[model samples]
Target: MSESRLHLHLHFHFLSLLFLSCVSPSYFSTTNPDDNSYVACGPHQAQVLTEFMNEFDSSHCNLSDPYNGVWCDNSTGAVTMLQLDDCLTGTLNPNSRLFMLHHLRYLDLSHNNFISSSLPSKFGSLNRSYPKRAHW
Candidate 1:
């Protein structure tokens, strides 16, 4: 083969190997080799619901607050639910409102530490698609 042709072939072979390495299972697999604490759940279960609940409990000591956290499957979006009770009672940070507004449904913050105020007028704008009957 000509020198240029040989170099081109070698370049293509290297490119193919690089692509295969990037797409291989060893690179994309969900199994963590370091710490096996990772739970590989489906799209619905990918949300950080349990972690948010634990954080809420740890941060504010309220066990019954029903605000859940959701992580979008295809995107890096994470939607957190901060109920009025949690917000007013100082269990959840009010600054979390920015991240909690998108992609949510059921927010139950009843009988915890709220001061009994009316719901926010813009509460309906929140995207809370997950129903209570759904499992995630």
Candidate 2:
């Protein structure tokens, strides 16, 4: 397989493992990793998330804000879930930093005012079952 395909394969594997794993409700309940004694969110993962957030006009939102949340795997230090709602304002481009989050299993961008933005085909690539829509 090509390098890109290999990368995609590994990415899919990682996401699959994350999705299959059962995490505690308390894990998702914490908005700040600092609140916990053990560091779950890796510095690099946090930086990527920060850069992704910077792509939009999220001046009103912060990492610890109630409207925005980030969950990271303690074992892998990879971001697993992101919830950014009602606080972002910008266009989501095809090459947005948001797509750099290969480890993300859950993403919520609800009630955001994104102007003239359309879901890029890459968004569909995230789900292996997404192509099944054609058969249905």
**Best by the TM-score measure:** 2
Q: Global lDDT of each model?
A: 0.30, 0.49
Candidate 2 colliding pairs: none
Candidate 1: tens digits of C-alpha lDDT, residues 1-136: 4433333322332222122222222222132223432323233322333323322322333223221121222232233222322221322333333333345443434333322133334434443454442210
**lDDT winner:** 2
RMSD of 2: 12.5
* TM-score of predicted structure 2: 0.61
Give the alpha carbon lDDT tens digit for every residue of 36-126 in model 2: 5343566666555555655555544443432135667767777766655455655666887667777776665555555533555777776
TM-score of each: 0.30, 0.61
* TM-score, predicted candidate 1 vs. hidden true structure: 0.30
